[model samples]
Target: MKKLSMLLLASALALSLAACGQGKQTGGVKEPAQAQQGDTGKAPQATSKKTTYPLTLKDSSGKEFTFAKAPERIVSLSPTETEVLFAIGLGDKIVGVSDLDDYPAEAKSKPKMGNLQGNPEAIIAANPDIVFAGLSLNKNSVTKLNELKLNLFQTNPKTIDEAIDRVLLLGVITDKQDQAEQVAGQMKKEKQQVVDALKGLKPEQKKKVYIEFSPGWTVGKGEYLDDMIAIAGGVNVASDLQGWKQISEEKVIQANPDVIFFAKGVPNLEKTIRERSGWDKIAAIQGGKVVGLDDNLMSRPGPRITKALVDMAKALYPELVK
Candidate 1:
């Protein structure tokens, strides 16, 4: 009986020890290393919050807009911004575009949101993160967009410097600063080359160029085209007037421009000025210096402006093809 009781006591002690070991294996004991973390399955917390900035942008019409964050899905409501977007390598992010954005070939593929003034509904439907426009964009529409909580960036570039600055600004907004700088640098180089090419040409060697736009409207002094004409090594014969204005037919004859550039938008324009009324007497008509050019290229302040300069050079100075 005593031996049996002693054996039973030994078995009870072994079972008790086994139970303690199993408890330890099941993680019942506190571990200092494991207690360092607040929770086992929780992910590591972030050190800081993401940084954001409030940006204020002014459009051509002197309107200002503020944004809390950078816009991703941009809707281009102006042809200028569309061209700028493509120039700065943000073309892929364009969610919507205006009907006027015909350059870069890819613009045609983007969803059309109608004209700038009447396309707010389409814009809202597209749900773009931002809208890019020019001075011509309607204030009411802009207000509506704002009410819908869409960010708007309005750009109006009057001079070449402004144009370059606008491109860089767009690049910054789209997070493509390096690409914008490269494009701006290339354009600046091309412009310098144009200026350099015209170094020695005398005023007499330069053609008297007339850039005619509608029936009576023509680009005068203090316009983008005038700057391009001077840059492209041609003297704008109509530089006497300020801005785009109407002038008499007799005045065109009096100026006697050696070359007349008919921008594509002119009404009733034809090969022969003789066919038109009150224009045959002009010196350009007599000398056959009328040249048709794509107005979009000349008017737009995008990367293609350099190409327009080259085209003008080709037209004005055909002899120096070497």
Candidate 2:
């Protein structure tokens, strides 16, 4: 039970991360003009202006940050934020990243700050103009980072759409509004294409999905993966449970989902599932429908989640999505 509990905690922390909400809301601390909210499979309109400085903004924690100028050096404690920063052309400006920031090939080369709970001493050593953090940060680390008074900010997005807004919001902070618009615009369009393709899918038409992202751990409602499954025209058999949970092998055998998604890099998950007693009766295993998705794509809530959405939609309903 101790190991199972640890796995559950790790699954939640390892996967779903967050970011900012919509920009252009009426507020004192403001961001650049936002792109259209309705996803119509079109690129966001380009704005000629950049993010104006003396920028005042709010982090996901509802803490405030004021930027006197576009930060020349940045440290990102969130892997998703690192990816979003890179997407908005701020890659060159980033001086450090979380141990987990591995996308785009370039981020991997940056200096590593510890993981979600950042290394405050290392962050200070990097001499960042600003710092971006993830939700999984431990309370102690949060207090230490705050005590050090390091131009700190945070993002904690619960959904993919929220992730898009974070991409735009980061632009607001870094003076990369145009690049953010273009990047998020592409994300919106790609996601809309998936939605359009899956439109009017009846509950019965959708595949029943079972996802085990970590060993003995799965996600349910109120989290990104379940939301992704729904958008992809699939039903989560685990939705009866809440966010990130230890799996019940008996329940899984009973639900007998049509498709099973396992995080790609977790060692031997597929093999374990296949070899598990009484799992042979599950339709997915018998039909060879178990799939492995890229762990980063599935875990990190960033601009690339749209890519994950498209991939998921295609996986479940290839005939419709294609």
Candidate 3:
């Protein structure tokens, strides 16, 4: 009986030690299944609290403005500015646009303020966070907007390079810097491609080009169209003049350009050019080398100017580009 009790005691002690070992295993090392359900799982991701506002930027006129937050309701007083805003993914933020804005098809539906002379009352009624204007905005209108403590940014891009820079600046102000950089970079790349394609042209290979916006209105040395013509491997015959001005029919006849480009929006433009009294004598008319292009692409300093350059190059040198 004593030997049997001693054996039972020994068995009990071994069982107790086994239980303690199992307990330690359960408490110290978790099973794979338990790990997936507990502290080993991913922690909740923290949200970014970076602020893009209290932003200050200088406009083309060297005037500075500050924004407390990203502009939610932007009023674009210039059609070019309207295009720029839309191109950089800020179309949904636009509250108002100028009367002349028609590109991207959506801008046409936006509330239209007056062109050149913007309606201050209408602009104020829109409750815009910011306003983008051109030099056409009269001094009185600017004063009224100022009196109301409204933010008005003037966009005056004199060259294609400046226009691209403006896109980047707008991106910074609107909290879409990445999108804007992509747009500006693509534009620069496309423009440089065109430049590279035409860089090897000899002086003799360059064609004399004439562009007529209206009946008598032609682009001159300082204008974007003139620059486009030169970049597209053509020489603007009216480069002697500066800015948008009328060239006498006599001078146009003397220039006798190899190609003629007319603004596409003008009514009966091709017919008007063909029926002009002495135009039949012009080389372009004789060779039927007249092409029509979108006036906005040539006029507006926006992202689409690269498209305009491609169109102009194709029109001027069909064999080379194709």
Candidate 4:
């Protein structure tokens, strides 16, 4: 009877051990499966939660600003920002514009605040939900806006990529992300097409080009105009200088660029260039390679920069671009 009892106890212990091992193996397999299922179920919820408002972001000035909700009444103090707002389908939300915001035709109808030195009182009187200002806004104005507790965002893009980023940022703040993405995507596609077309040209093959915003104002390094010039398969003659500077006629004469581009509405641009002393002897003038481009398209840091690239490419390499 003692041996039978011990044998029964040993069999019961063996069955318990086997069941424990099986349970562990089953749990090991099922746990990972359950965890994976849980993660999969959570992914959509996580993704959908993105971009919910009271969104916060640092502006170009590195100041943190929070939007309790998407701004419905926007005041644009920069023409470029105005164009961006309109491009992203926020035109109806625009309550006021700067004196210089004269694009899209509709922007002209908005009440004018002030120019680079934005009128704080005028801006405040507009009762805007948010204000979009340029980098040129004075420190005092910014301080005044801060004192008034006005939500101010700065739009200052030094490059085409920065411009696109600003557009997307505006879209986020205005709840027009999809439209902004579409605009940005199209800009990228168009810019890439220009880049791809110019990719095959060797450095030596690139044409020497000159661009004049006015009689003396020209772009240099660190400017999008310079980037556009290079992207269009041409070298900016004034690139040696930095930023917007007045170019000496002697320097321009020395550069003798193969092509010359002037911003349109420069008051008799062709006539002025043709009449300039010694300019008649320049290679561009002699070859009739001088071209006039739309001022806003080339100068404004907006979605139309791609159009500027196409226009510039057409001007520089007429055969390569249609």
Index of the highest-lDDT prediction: 2
On TM-score, the leading prediction is: 2
TM-score of 2: 0.85
lDDT of 4 at 20: 20
Per-residue lDDT of candidate 2, residues 71-102 (tens digit): 99999887777888888888889999877677
TM-score of 4: 0.82
Q: Name the 10 consecutive residues with the lowest summed lDDT in model 4.
A: 8-17
Q: Any residue pairs clashing in model 4, and if so which?
A: none
What is the per-residue lDDT of model 1 for residues 52-131, given as tens digits with 9 covering 90 to 100?
Answer: 34644444444454556557688987666788788878887898987767878999999998865538778888888878
| Candidates arranged by lDDT, highest first | 2, 4, 3, 1
Q: Judged by TM-score relative to the true structure, which candidate is superior, 1 or 2?
A: 2
Over 142-236, each residue of candidate 4 has an lDDT whose tens digit, in order, gives 89888998888775566666667666767667777778778989988888888877777889988999988776777788777788888899999
Over 97-196, each residue of candidate 3 has an lDDT whose tens digit, in order, gives 8776787899999998766457888888899989888754668988888898888877655456666777776776777766777888988887787787
lDDT of 3 at 315: 85
- In order of appearance, the predictions have TM-scores of 0.74, 0.85, 0.80, 0.82
lDDT of each: 0.64, 0.76, 0.72, 0.73
lDDT score for residue 42 of model 3: 77
Off by over 4 Å in 1: 1-57, 65-67, 138-149, 264-268, 272-274, 320-322
RMSD of candidate 3 to the truth, in angstroms, is: 26.1
